[model samples]
Target chain A: MLFKGIAASHGIAIGPAFLLKVEELRHARRTLIDSSESEEEILRFRDAIISVKHDLENIADSMGDVVEGRQILEFLLLLLQDPTIKKEVENKIRCDKVNAEYAVSSTLLDVMDKFNIMKDPYIRERVADVKDVGRRIIEKLTGTEKDALNNLKQPVVLVARDLDPSETAGLKPGQVLAFVTDMGGKTSHTTILARALGIPAVVGLQKITVEIHPQDLIIVDGIHGCVIVNPTEKELSYYAEIREQFQEAESLLQQANPGPALTEDGVRYELAANIELPHEVEMVKSLAADGIGLFRTEFLRLIQEKGENEEDHFDIYNKMALDMLPKPVIIRTYDMGGDKFRTGLNSAREANPFLGYRAVRIGLDRPEEFSIQLRAILRASIHGNIKLMFPMVTHVEQLRSLLDLIKLVKNDLRVKAIPFDENMQVGIMVETPATVIALDLMLPYVDFVSIGTNDLTQYTLAVDRGNPKVAYLYDSFHPAVLRQIDTVVRLCHAQQKWVGVCGSMAANPLAVPLLIGFGVDELSVAPSLIPDVKKMIAVVTTHAAREMAEKSLSIETGLRVRALVHSYVIGKYPEILLDENDWKTGG
Target chain B: MIEKKITVPNKLGIHARPAALIVRAAVEFDCDVWVESPADKVNAKSIMGVMTLAASGGTLITVSAQGDQEETAVETVVEVIRSGFGEEMI
Candidate 1:
């Protein structure tokens, strides 16, 4: 029987299934106690936990983003604070019945058992979390440590049921060629880590242990999430050709890196990246982005406990604007509704967060906070080309209210003799169906409009992205979604306002041609995906894209639109086409 | 000890939170605190002085302190400006 899973991480390795069975854990625990003797064992156990704490801290320090690392450190700190575990060992010492090592082992078993019995998957996963903490502690105690990957003599493809952030962090790029896991979703830490490391990984292969034999010849395609076992020569040759084509295409994209994203007909389109943090400025520069298309400012508000002040907003925005200098940066003011802002501020628990008081609505409600941000933005504008964009504007009244606030803030600045850009360009993100319908009314008020397809598609289809059952219905290519996008783009263009798209759909190669045809002036995507999307855009003529968009819009079914776009893109640029077998095989 | 007044260059001003970040850095040394703006002058350690400065981002004010760490405190406040008051993304 053949089973396929989403290949999230990339690389191919054929190795015997070294299933990390629960029984090995049982053996290791049993051995831990059997080998220990006397009161000296408690000292050893304490030393072990201490060493693990140090190791965890070191790992956290080495990570690029301290957020996840800090989380793991906090977890370790909690484990050390576990009164039950501490008391058990102390009781053993006082009773003169068992050694410290035995006490520690028994306490660990109790904690692990509790974690395993948790009904919540997240809680149950904590069992591995405990084990990982245990392994680090034990390694420190026993002094029988394996060198950190640099000591590995032979390269191995790591196969795990699943890997946590801590475990994945310890993997060395040289020792691990690739990874395959039996479980993990696309946004799982395993997938993110794999992408960051540029390693190929396949995840969510349920019951892979049964099908994959140890030492089976397996070819893994990380991009398409395919794994081939004992492939025929024909299959190997086919993959080889595909691999060569991909490399050539990659090289071509690299050559185009220093060049502008212009079509064969010489129409240049602005290519920018959407960013969540100030740190991402480096990534945009590396991609040679025109500038930040959308800087989601809410991340700052989320990271801090209190509300963000104007100085904080100004400082960050000013720094980003100055850093990106010359390149125009469009900052979408805090789009903090939905899951993003629920934790703090006036954010209330809403049944439908996407449609609730968010973006400009919330900004308008709290003029003081909004003015602080606006003033900082205004102040930062003097440093570089910075534009302000409000998200989730549904009506002309909302736009007008926001514009009035901007004018008021500008006037206030002028009265204070504070220097600011008098004519800063302001824009709105047309994300809601209401906003799409009222584009003509809004067109005259704003400088430009960016179509946020992610939310737009979700709202159009009335499907929550978080709900797995209905997630498939949230299609960007849906006729309704496309029609809204097209209307907004066309209307904006007619009114001489520039329009762009900053959504997952914008980066999608299949949607690029259609977007171009829809008269999208810019495509803002993840920095890493920019080159590939640019390459796709370079091959297709504006004429072809328009034709494809026209065909796509007339289609009644979302799948048909997707299929048409896929075929249109592949027909024009076969090199950019993802391998079907690789996509299906769960490599 | 030489004392200099510097307004909170940060948009947030010397409020409780940015005040917390500032005071935490201040307590690392031994110094007497005072801050003054056009409107008022008050104890630097006094959260009130920082607040009264009403130093929103880009506001100009003065900072002064005394002790062996006086120069250090004054310089540190000035450094916040050079670094954009910890807002500068490196």
Candidate 2:
């Protein structure tokens, strides 16, 4: 049976599968004898660990440039220094006459068992890492070797619940046709590695392990989130046709690059990219973005260590701004709340964290802290076209308070004679229902506003998007959500403030017409989706979009509004319907 | 011995990491270090002592150290305060 899952990495191939099962561990409860043989065994085990360490260092030295290789080195170092492992070995040496090899193996098994039984998926995956390291050590100690996939002459599709960083590095790109995982997300290490390797992959397939059989003749369409298992002749023929069409479409899109994002009727739309990390600057450059629409600054502050101070933050912001110089980079100041900052920020423990002290609110509550960030932002503004934006503003007073704080910092800088761009444009994210409704009050205060549709939809619909049970209520096309977006867009445009949308919906082909119709100045989407969204925008007419936007805003029900907008767009542009089909089928 | 009272301007009080950053800065001077919050006082260099204060953002505390470097320690701690303990959120 065909199984569908989220496509994390893109590509396609057919190959035999190799399954690496978790090893069962048996503990050596017997006390070590003080005999000479036991002492010799201890010496052997110690030598084996030393050899394993040497092997790890060798691998690191050989593949030092690769991220996976670096990660293996990091894991090996952590294992070598783990106190528990040391304590276990010391106990065996003191109590049992067993050799070091047996003692180390026993300790490794204990650690693997402890990690394997963990309920957290992230922690549980560490068992695989432990095993990978332990296997190397055991091999070195026992001098017993088994063929480690080196003998598999045929190309194989690797299937796993998830591949640890170390395991992923050992995978030979030439021999591995594709990757299929039962669990992962877009940001998973496995997904990132697969994408980097340019191998086709599908992840978050909760049932892939149970459903897929050995050598099932599976076809994985990573782009479309479809997997075909034991396909019939008809399905096989259909997929071949689709594969050809997709290749042609991709080549056409490639040719269309570095061109104006203009419709056939000569309407131009600014295509921008939303970025979460500084590393994604390359992606923006590759996509040829007009600018970065929403540079989420929270990532810099969310590292495992202490949150970045003003200086560290300034360095990052300055680097990104200068790297993407000449292009207007709108950075949304730390939007830490919900699931994103739950563990990272100590202040994010409130019952209703989404509506609690976060974003500009946190900044306002603590002016000293707020000033540090403002100073960094204002300082970075001089390096490039750095525009500051506040997220989750529910009231006009909040914006006023935030603006006042910025002004104070600016004045302080002025007094201190620190050079700064006093005219740096400020903006607020129109994400909440309160903010959208109070657009008139908010319009005159900020230089610009970006509609963060993801949160706006969730807030307007009163739904917690992360909760799967209430996910159905998180529709962006719902009439109320559309109306809110339309209201803010219209208000911002009337006030002469260039309004943009930075959200998942902005990149959605179906929503492009409505956004354009609402007269949004810019549509910022994920860097990867820019070409497709631009392609759709090129086919759509501004006037038709405006009409559809009006109709959508007037509707009361989300389903009705969605149907009306979808039908109108499809009826006016038949090519869109075809694109929609292709999109659904992973075309 | 010199003692100067100062409020924690940073949002997350003298937490372990920030406390460590503060301790590193404080130990640069030769002085006996102690940070006293409203509830208790702790050795500025002791990570456990600093954490016990449970000082959060905006909590006022006094920093005192005794020795020849007392003046330098106090000045350094005050600088951290003035800089909001280098925390993004004060």
Q: Give the per-residue lDDT digits (tens) of candidate 1, residues A1-587.
A: 23466656433443323222211222122212332344456666677767777777777778757775666565554555343466666566546455343455556677777656644344455566556665555445434222423355666555566664424434555566566776664434455456545456777776565455444556667767777766778877877777676556656675676667887577888898777667668867877888899887766674445666777888898899989989989988877666455545554578777677677778888888788888889999986499999998887888888889988999998899988877789999977788888789888898998988877877787877544345445567778988888898889878899999987677667778889998899988766567877787787788888898888778987777777777666777786645353222211
Q: How large is the interface RMSD of each prediction?
A: 18.4, 10.4
Lowest summed lDDT window (length 10), candidate 1 chain A: A22-31
Q: Cα miss at A513, model 2 (Å)? A: 0.7
Model 2 chain A TM-score equals 0.65
TM-score of each: 0.58, 0.58
> Where does candidate 1 stray beyond 4 Å?
A1-222, A226-252, A302-307, A346-349, A577-587, B1-90
Each prediction's total of clashing residue pairs, residues at least 3 apart in sequence or on different chains, is 27, 17
Which has the greatest DockQ?
2
- CAPRI rating of model 2: incorrect
